[model samples]
Target: MDATPGVISTLFTNAKVFTGETETTFASAFRVTAGVVDWVGDESAATGDITVDLGGRTVLPGLIDSHTHPALIAGTAPAAECFPPAVTSADDLVAVLRAHADGLTDPDAWVLGRGFDDTKFPGRRMPTAADLDRVSTTRPVLVWRCDAHSAVCNTRALEIAGITAHTPDPDGSRFERDADGEPNGVLTEIAAVGAVAAFIPAPTRDAQIDALVGLGEELASRGIVAVCDLLSTRIDDPVATFRTAVDRGLRTRVALYPGWDPVAPLADLAAGDREGQIRIAGVKVVLDGAYSNRTAWVHEAYPESCDHGLRLVDDADVLAAAEWARRNHVQLAIHAMGDRALDRVVELFADAEPWLDGIPSVRIEHATIVSDDYLARLRAARMSFGIATHTVFFFAEYDGYEKALRAEQVPDAYPIARLYAGLDPLALSSDRPATAWSGADDVMLSVEAAVRRRTYNGIDFGPEAAITVPQALLLYTGRARLLSPLEGVGQLAPGFDGSFAVLDRDVFTVPEDEISAVRVAETWIRGERFS
Candidate 1:
């Protein structure tokens, strides 16, 4: 993980840095050379091989996620089927898959699990393939349900993918069937879980470069140097698997993006002219489906159903992929959770707003349902937002898709206090394997659900959509520095990138329900520490 050559080693002295448009505290002492920030507010003209004091604690800027899926929680297996959080019967999720297949001794190899919140079980149903053949009718499983859209598999993984009950349902996805029309192994979206996740296998490219180098050392032990990879791997080349995990260093800075491909990994990132260290930068577009599975694409209807949602792309291919991502300058996130896929993604970015050439901004990912005339067309097209605060801690465990999205649009759910009294600037993302990927306790449970919009049933589901823990740490840091604000990214100034995040306590002086118990006492990143 080299690349720092011309000077400075590491300094860090008694810190506090969070200066992303200040709230206070610039009282610093940085100096991380060869990895940027060659001196941020003195400390005896900073020199270094490693100094580190930080006793005064608090140094942020190194969290930027802006939508993830880093190879599904960069798994080393055991993500207990993603987020079942609590099983509460289907024999308590077949005894959590028979104690995760009794620590697997190869009961037929493929036993991958995933998060499973069928709206907190008990009849929010979904698990059949005879509920994973009651946990291994001879292995072959497939779990995934907390909303990585959908998947359940099991009659020995639907007879090893031949998916019976006379298959057919794939177009734009959905294959559950039932009432005697059979095929009920449950699988949806990505055209019915991309035909059984294209028959499993895929992983290797050196196990996707050891799961993107153990997901960049688990986001540099949770201080996350930079991110925005936005999950995608059916493999047929993700820019040669991110240039073989950025020529093997995989140190994490990756602004990657690729998925929703009508063939666009842009020819080996213009045959490697996108320079490397994993930065391809742009092209996401989910277009709808996922408000915890009612299948978000709404323009009403949802309450008791009669389905008026689910539009996974197609408004003439969202105006021809927003005019081919504005004639190829690229960058176009666009997931849009609903509110009619965020008003047809603001009418296809206002019909590609006169071919947006210079590419300043353009993102949407989970811009969870907004509507004050689409927050005034995203503040008159100044557009950019990633939002996903782990669905406010997944509606604080209440469920049934938070009672059918509070009975259909409880005034636009993910509205973090109208994006903090709207002056527009957003980024926060944690859509990991669809929520709850560890480290930094999910960014301190997204700063205690954006400063207590209180859920875990204690109610107040939108106390004016609360916000403030320094505006949820500037939506995971300076509006995630507009996804690569000239690469120094999210902040902590000087030549940037010294990478921080220590936090054991003092999340802006805690007490927002004890900011999810703090604890991440070390993380660093470019300057190294790791965790």
Candidate 2:
């Protein structure tokens, strides 16, 4: 149950509390008054209105996922689960959809699913409309790629969206076609996919709220207390939807970075007074797509193809967004994954240095591929940008990346340690749903990948990029605040939000491989236990 404002207090004792600043720091007890930590000290000095023994459990500041898409996930909750690590083959994917279609009562309603990785399929080829048609020719179907940058739609869906061979490919995106000039139902990038997505029935506001509420509890159960909802404006009126979620009892604190497009004008969303557990911290701008989909806009050509990935946004648009964010006193969280994209972003930030004052630090989402020269350029520019990346992708989509990029580039894929070495206040996150793996949302899984530097198949992609257990923990806990404007979080100090995760064992002492298997015995948020 939630504590009534200003009337609740509790004391947690007999636990090893990791303050998150260092590996050796520990406290035996803490008291929460209302929703903030009132005191933290030895067990003998603890006192509160309500006291409970923790039985020597290990506790740490509640985990914060620096980047995620809760609204997008909620909006697509009706879709069937087609993420990799769950369904490995095209046939398995079809079976999952068939089962989902059979259970749906609406025969004519569109069937939607997300998180399908063609690279994981046995044939290593994306599923086409014909593949989905095998499940249902009558019902329109659209399944998003794991990257969410591309998608495959069934014939019915294509017809419904009016995407034909004659339809001109939108700028920065294209429609894959057959040799005979027919739409193959494969849409790449936001421009192409959004064209079809615009026609899909929008979930009701209540449904959206319910999806967020359910996801909040799910995240809380996994020991996540807050999330930086990257791309919050993917849905119309994200601010209102988040407000509704809070009213409906969302346990996780959210900091929103609505996507910034000059055409859309998100500066208005950043205006007005901030509300409880929800704030527009910045603007999100995507300069490129995912590497797994071969659209990351890298400097070099892919292994098999003589083509570097695609650049989704123009330089002029990115510069304009950066300037707008700076003027509005908000952070600009640019998504630049590829080497070429990072180069462009670094150049743009360097140019925008004049207006950067008074604004929160800029953030680069998914700095997946970085070279030594790129790092030197970033350091030379001395811009106030932080990196919020994911190790889950390194493990989940290792095969696809390995197949696409040069063998030498594999070790530098995530570059977790290297990012920390250059970018002060670096943070880590699981770009869940955007990643190929179903466990992308799991903190332990991300921690394990970051620490072990190994893929799911135990392939060492970038052992040199690995960090210590404490350093990895800081990415999700202590250092997360650098990526967002959320205060009184990422620590257990006095006046901080009384949020912490009670673990079954001390993760700091556990064997590295055993990290992912560690469980959250309980999770508390704002003076109340939710999971």
Candidate 3:
């Protein structure tokens, strides 16, 4: 349906419209005027210049991914995909990568393959430099582990980085060594991965902009109208790059949280950049690594391991990041995935008042583990903090969680129900390509995982904490908005942006087990069809 901004209007009828926070949760129809929701009520009362029947499909407020990494996804793409349920073994990985390398035209092009999980393999064995060398001898090869926390590279890539037996391990990260203390090409954590990755040619600005445009279409297919790039500064110029992508028809509205760097700060936000579809909402500080690699900064040691996990940032650096957000009049987003890191954040913010109001002062990217005392302390703190947690983490990394978490800690992992009842701005988001699952960005997959509390392999994660459909929807819509700096979004009410998704089936009535199979049929943005 097409409509004039202030004159012509469009009425979408015969739908189970969920106006997230409207007078009625379920409306039969909605009217879009001036490219925004002008009215939403019973079909009998909807008056507009044009009417289109929706055939009784389910319509929801446009979905939001509160903590995805689209720029990261785009940046890592065009590499040979190495994620499972296809690449099941180390042998399978070698075959897939070898085929990818064989297909490439450039003999010297970096053979980059990402997404492989060795934990799910027969003996929990990771592929090594020797295994990757079978794929190529001349070209540099670096394949990231499914968790994105570490990577294993071929000898060529290692040699190119100038890493050898004598190179000392960086704090919180290391290069896995062999019997003779030789760097074995297993780069553990971002510091190790970047050593070689920084040598790879940066994607051309045009290539990156093109990738963003394509990523937007991909997002629209999943019913996402808005997303937050949790770590955007990984690119050359995040703000400008995303702005260009939006101008070039990137469908998803993006809120960027450039990584906090004391030495190299983000360019000052333009007045216009502070309040648009593409905006610089804040800066991100990754406080720790993830659980899959046993790097989540847990309070206790992993089973059979003395490792308590890696805390990547120091207190001074994190406080400095907070100061930057306060000084720049933006928010601070912290990636704290373990109880120890969460304790650090709770301690850091407990004494300070919220730097901003209306929006959350601080956004916790992954509050993976929270205790009763931790929750109470966070609530008692003067600073307001929101949580953007993920169920997909457990869904995709079940074996890792099984290995890393103690028996008593299992129920506490992403306890969506507890967080729902306790946190106001709490939302569930897909960490995406960063996750091991192939369709980690699929909203229904995460919803099913949350509601069923089951892993992909049918193991129960924490069924006692499962929530209802409506609650999960709010995390992806109404409440998810609280995690974003973008305004006038994540709702279907009169004043909200005219963006929504039409589902192929009634999600509210679907069998809990079948929810993962549900698909989005249509998406609308600003009262116009998106996909």
Candidate 4:
């Protein structure tokens, strides 16, 4: 019961300890000393200063979210929730916005909301500024689509941003307008959204830290002991924010990858500061946009659309960034979703293979729409690459993918089995607020989805793409550790960090569909109980 680090000794017995490698093998007990596993064996061989029984519960490696945007999620905490799960129609969305704006004392303050999916609306139409204008004409309102690739602003918000019929669209993005050349209040891609985002009030450093600390506790409660903050610099100083969060008693370990915009400061940031629970792992680059928003840069066009998705970063820019990461000996986490984007990324890696000798492994974030040919190319190249993907999107937002992609493409939407086909290391993540459902952060929910390949509507999306429970679990545990530069974590073996989660039931023994129902009874990080 005394789950604290720096204890002389602690023994955990009478539990099924899943080693994260195989499902059939287990140890009944483990001994921890000074935040490290001293020994793991049968109950008869256990020895420690204090002992407690787990009552035949299950224990596994503390979960690691290989890819997530904790900083962005925290930033959105102060905003109103207009996600599809909460609001189904444009009227419902307007009501939520009105309620949020009404609760705000500042009449002039912007009312911001996120996670809106117009595809799920009763009319299957995106909400326009006109729809939001129905909520409030005085208050400027901004709401992001679920993918964060698009957004809708009220007429007041447009006026505040100085966006008018004469305002030319930013490069790489477009402003949806009516037939008469009037701004429709819908903005697509980051370039367009950033224009209006400049007018929105930024969160204070103290507020950012608090939001991060709260997020850390939330992760710990879900049995997440560590996370790779894929995009860390949404705020001013991400490193300082993470350090402050740790100082405020955030037990979750963090590995940060700052944006690779200028590309000069990355080497210094990676070399100068490597302290506390945070480390600068590498640089992050977005090669393309999200599939849900019809901007994933696919080789083939969407169902009825003439053009493929957008490519956010140029191909040359991606290669140059890779070269810089290679020279600096850091990882390059490229966000690529469509086949074209992945192909370009694979080619870049292939070209940079010799330079990648001592560098950290390159990562492909959200490799959602990979093709077999590209997968073979990746395999043939024999490069040190990692695929950090999510099944939460498959379960939560398959409807959107179904609407945009061809029926044949749906089978490979996430492609967990195919990604693992060549025995490549795969790391699963939630992508948090970007996901379709509220339970995106729940590892068990993702596990069940990956194993069952079922969507929220109870339809089988891709049965052949389904993986076993153990394979899915490894994506969050052993396999995930390969993506991380951290050591002595993500396993329950001797010499590993004494971090593990005690589950209310043995997930390995339960039916696959019931995996999400499994709850974490206790979560320990560095032998200290966090939840």
TM-score of each: 0.34, 0.95, 0.97, 0.95
Ranking by lDDT: 3, 2, 4, 1
Q: Candidate 2, residues 1-531: lDDT per residue as tens digits?
A: 222355667888899898776656689998888789878889787666688899999998999999999978877778898987788887888898988888889777778889899998876988998899988898999999999899999999999999887999988898999898899989999889988888888888888899999999999998899998888876778878888888899878888888876676754443453456788777888888888888888888888788787888787888778776767677888898888888888777754453344323578899887767766776676567678888898789987887777888876678888887776667888888798988688898989999999999999887998988778888888877666777778888887999999999888889998999998999999888999
Tell me how candidate 4 scores on lDDT.
0.81
Which residue segments of model 4 deviate by more than 4 Å? 1-7, 262-267, 270-276, 354-360
- On lDDT, the stronger of 1 and 4 is 4
Q: Rate the local accuracy (lDDT) of all candidates.
A: 0.65, 0.83, 0.86, 0.81
Lowest lDDT 10-residue stretch of candidate 1: 351-360
Off by over 4 Å in 3: 1-6, 22-24
TM-score of 1: 0.34
Judged by TM-score, which candidate is best? 3
Q: Write the per-residue lDDT of candidate 1 for residues 343-402, one digit (tens) a residue.
A: 776765643344333333467776666756677666666444334344444444446557
**Clashing pairs in model 1?**
81-114, 81-115, 82-114, 82-115, 83-115, 84-116
Alpha carbon lDDT at 386, candidate 2 = 74
Q: Which tens-of-lDDT digit does each residue in 85-171 have in candidate 4?
A: 788889988999888888888767789888878878886788899999998888888998888777899999899999999999886
- What TM-score does prediction 3 earn? 0.97
Over the full model, what C-alpha lDDT does candidate 2 score relative to the true structure? 0.83
Lowest summed lDDT across 10 adjacent residues in model 2 is found at 351-360
- Which candidate comes out best when scored by lDDT? 3
**Clash count in backbone of candidate 2:** 0
The superposed Cα distance between candidate 1 and the true structure at residue 451, in angstroms, equals 30
